[model samples]
Target: GFAGNTIPIVAGSALLALRALEEDTKANGKITITRGDNPWVDKIYTLMDKVDEFIPTPERDTDKSFLMAIEDVFSITGRGTVATGRVERGSVKVGETIELVGLGNTRTTTVTGLEMFQKTLDESVAGDNVGVLLRGVQKTDIERGMVIAKPGTITPHTKFESQVYVLKKEEGGRHTPFFCGYQPQFYVRTT
Candidate 1:
C-alpha cells in the first residue's frame, strides 16, 4: 500500500496549491509570475502569473495564499501510511479525510487514511506536513496543484471569481487602470 499512502499525500498537497492559485485571482484578477527557485515546483508558480496579486485562501479569505510542499514519502513495515507535506501555515494531523481533487478539474476523491511524523493516526489536522495513506484512488489520476477538502466541502469551480493583474512587461503595464475587458488564458484545479 506504499502507492496508496504516497498518492494521497502528493494529491492532497497538490490540492492545497490550488487554494493559493485562487488567492492570486483575487488580488490582481490576473497576474504573471516567474517560476520559483525550484524548477519543477516553480513551474507551477509561473502558471499563476496570469492571475492577479490578491489570492483567495481555502477559507475564502482575501489574505495571501498559504504554501504547501510535498517533502517525501517513506514506508514502514506494518504501518500503512506515507510521509508528505511541508507545512507553511497551519498544522496537519491524523484521522481526517480530506477532499482530493485533480488539477484542471474540480471533481474530487476522499483521503481515507492518514498519519503524522511517525505515529500511526487516522487523520492529520493543520500546520506541519504529514504522511498519509489513501483509499479508492489511483496514482496516474493525480498531478500537481490538485484540490483536496474535508469531505463534501470541496466545490467544483467551472467559472468562478478572481483578481487578475496584467503582466507589466507584456503590455508595458500601460493599460487603463481599473479597466476590466480582457480574458487571458485560465488555469486552475479540476477533478
Candidate 2:
C-alpha cells in the first residue's frame, strides 16, 4: 500500500521532470505514461495528458532501409551466427541482405532467418525484438553495440562527438576530469 501510492507519484514526477528537460533541449518526442490501476493513477493520467499536449510526434525517416541495434551475438549449432536486438528502423525480411557496422569495420551478410520468442518470422519491423540468423558470419565477428542495417545505409565512424550529463557529483570530494583515451565499459540497449 505504501509503495502503491508513493511509487506512481515519484515516477510521475520524474517523468514530468524529464519532459521539462526535453523541452529545454528542444527534443522531439512524446512521453506517454502507463501504469497499473492505483490511487495515484488519476494524477499520472492528468500529467500524461498535459505532457502530450506540448510534445510533438517524432518524425519518421523516409528511407526504406532497415536498422537494428545489436544487443547479443551468439552461434547455434545449425544456425550459424545469430544477432538479437530490436529493429530500430524500417523492416527486414527473411532473405534480405544487411550489413553489420561497428568496431571500425563492416561486414555484409545475408539474413538466413528471423525468430521472435522461438517462433520463426518471415519479417521483422521497427520495435520488434527478433533474433536474426546471419549467413557467412561467425560469432566472433559480431558483438553488442553493433548496428545491423541495409547495405550502404550505414557507415562506421572512426570518431564522433557527444554531450555527457553527469547526473550526480561524487559525495566526498571534487570530481576528477577524464582525460583523452580513458576507456569506460560501454553498455548500449541492454547489452
Per-prediction TM-score to the true structure, in the order listed: 0.37, 0.61
Which regions of candidate 1 are displaced past 4 Å? 1-96, 102-112, 115-123, 170-191
Q: After TM-score superposition, what is the CA distance of residue 147 in candidate 1 from its true location, in Å?
A: 2.0
Model 2 ranges off by over 4 Å: 1-64, 170-181, 184-191
Question: How many clashes would you count in candidate 1?
Answer: 58
- Clashes in each model (backbone N, CA, C under 3 Å)? 58, 0
Q: Ten consecutive residues with minimal summed lDDT in candidate 2?
A: 30-39
Scored by CA lDDT, what does every candidate get? 0.46, 0.77
What's the CA error at residue 106 for candidate 2, in Å? 1.0
lDDT, candidate 2, at 16? 54
Give the C-alpha miss distance for residue 21 in model 1, angstroms: 47
The digit string of per-residue lDDT tens for model 1 on 82-130 reads 4366434433334444555434554334444555656666534455355
